[model samples]
Target chain A: AQSVAQPEDQVNVAEGNPLTVKCTYSVSGNPYLFWYVQYPNRGLQFLLKYITGDNLVKGSYGFEAEFNKSQTSFHLKKPSALVSDSALYFCAVRDIRYTGGFKTIFGAGTRLFVKA
Target chain B: GAGVSQSPSNKVTEKGKDVELRCDPISGHTALYWYRQSLGQGLEFLIYFQGNSAPDKSGLPSDRFSAERTGGSVSTLTIQRTQQEDSAVYLCASSLPGSYGYTFGSGTRLTVV
Candidate 1:
């Protein structure tokens, strides 16, 4: 089974400072990883995905994630954070060959608090 | 183009009652999915519908949770004998076949009392 792990329950960063949210995955073949953000009472919004390409993938709202194959990690990053960026973030992973037919397996989620 | 839409933005029902949540996917989308979100938690995949194939219900938490898609368009999720644990935001998403990104609806908040 493909699974994702977000070791951090929450991450705090001051406004204008860089932020990093850690994520790791376990899967059988190649992995398709994704990042999503959720605001209070709102559905998840896609941030970015890694489906075999450059290690660093850029996404919406000035967000980016680095895919490290050696460590099986995909960490979300931002050069500078804003108070509005405070929300819940999730890391998901899907096996390319599992074919058990599922969308993706999401992590427990990490609460991001960007203080102003 | 309009994104995915769900009805009954908020639902409050008593225990042992039945509830139905509706989802209208983006026009022309062939893949639809249902997910559950608890307060301050990540999404839990409930079910997925792809074209005319049988839906993947492996993620459903219990037999009381069931979903169906009509004409491969609108979908409905029915929860029977709802429990307090079932109270959460039910989200719906749609995507094209083989698409990477899924457009999500605002979600229906179901509260079981």
Candidate 2:
């Protein structure tokens, strides 16, 4: 079964400092991992995805994530955080060879708090 | 619409009532998905519709929960005998067949009184 785990429920960081939100996954086939962000009263927005090529993928809002196959991890990172970066982050995964319909398994989500 | 769209931004109904949530996927997108979000809990997959294939309903919690996509573009999720536990934001998303990234709607917030 395909699944994602976000070890930290919440992450705290100061403005202008680097931040990292960890994620790991388990899938039978080649993993199609993605990162999404959700702000207050807003639906999830796609941050980035790892389909193939370059392990580090850049996304909107100056965010990026590194896909590590050996460690089964795809961690979201930002060089310098901002107060507006505070939001909920989710890690999701899917398998390439889908059987019936598509199912993107998601982690419980981590609440990011970038204190100003 | 430019992105996935959901109807009834907010809905309140008494327990035991039935409710229907609608989703309009982006033009030309073939896959649609439904999920529920609750306090402290992440998104829970409800069902998925892809092209003309039968929806994958394994994630549906019970028979009272059902969904259908019409003409492979518009989708509706229905819940019968709604309970307080069902009060949560119902989110809809759509994507291309091979694409892993999904475009999500603002979601419909349902409150079961």
| Local distance difference test, each candidate | 0.91, 0.92
lDDT of 1 by residue, A1-116 (tens): 78899999999999999999999999888889999998876778999999988999999999999999999999999999999999999999864543434387789999999999
Clashes of 1: 0
Candidate 1 residues lying further than 4 Å off, grouped into runs, are A97-102
Chain A TM-scores, per candidate, are 0.94, 0.95
Query: What does DockQ come to for candidate 1?
Result: 0.58
TM-score of each: 0.96, 0.96
lDDT of 1 at A110: 97
Off-target runs (Cα >4 Å) in candidate 2 are: A96-101
Summarize candidate 2's per-residue lDDT along A65-107 as a digit string, tens digits: 9999999999999999999999999999985457544578889
Candidate 2 share of real interface contacts: 0.65
